[model samples]
Target: MTSSDPGALHAQTLSEAPCGRRLFIHALNAASGEGQEWVARLRELGFIEGEPVQVLRRGQPGGEPLAVRVGVSTFALRRAEAACIQVMPADAS
Candidate 1:
């Protein structure tokens, strides 16, 4: 991935993305059936690829289960669960 190329930039996992920065769902990094489950679950929760999300809060000042907003719904997720979600800056190409 190249920093200068928005298209080439590697997607950031939701667990590592800075709080308050809007992100676009880019991919699901889970493996095989696990990935499908995650993708289905996320989709059921309104978190499909190309949708916008933002980190709304953190747990225990610094812990798992980050609270995020997708569309008009807000939900909390553990770091491991969120790690499967790859995202890009919302305003990026």
Candidate 2:
């Protein structure tokens, strides 16, 4: 919440979220075409508003796919996909 950028507190994509951080879904930036498919898939995976999400693991230094826990399920997402999930720090929420 102390981040210089106010949006950093209110909203930031999961890709930028630190590992082991617990957060809440603020919104999902569902897009068209390929992203539209991801949006639908993510929704089916239970990436919805108000639900808690946690960054469990991440790819090595490259940081490609990130493993995350959403609700009671765990899934791996590419940084591009993770970037569409906007969330707020758990404490702030």
Tell me the lDDT of model 2 at 73: 95
Tell me the TM-score of each prediction against the true structure: 0.81, 0.83
Error of 2 at 89 (Å): 0.8
State the lDDT at 78 in candidate 2. Answer: 88
Best by TM-score, which number? 2
Worst 10 residues of 1 by lDDT: 1-10
- Evaluated at residue 87, the lDDT of candidate 1 is 88
Per-candidate Cα lDDT values, in order, are 0.81, 0.85
Give stretches of model 1 more than 4 Å off: 1-8, 31-35
Please provide, for model 2 over 1-93, each residue's C-alpha lDDT reduced to its tens digit, 9 standing for 90 to 100.
345756555798898889998999877876446888787788889999789998898988898789999999999998999987889988786
**lDDT tens digits by residue: candidate 1, 1-93:** 346755537588889988899888887667455777876788789888889989888899567689999998999998877887878997785
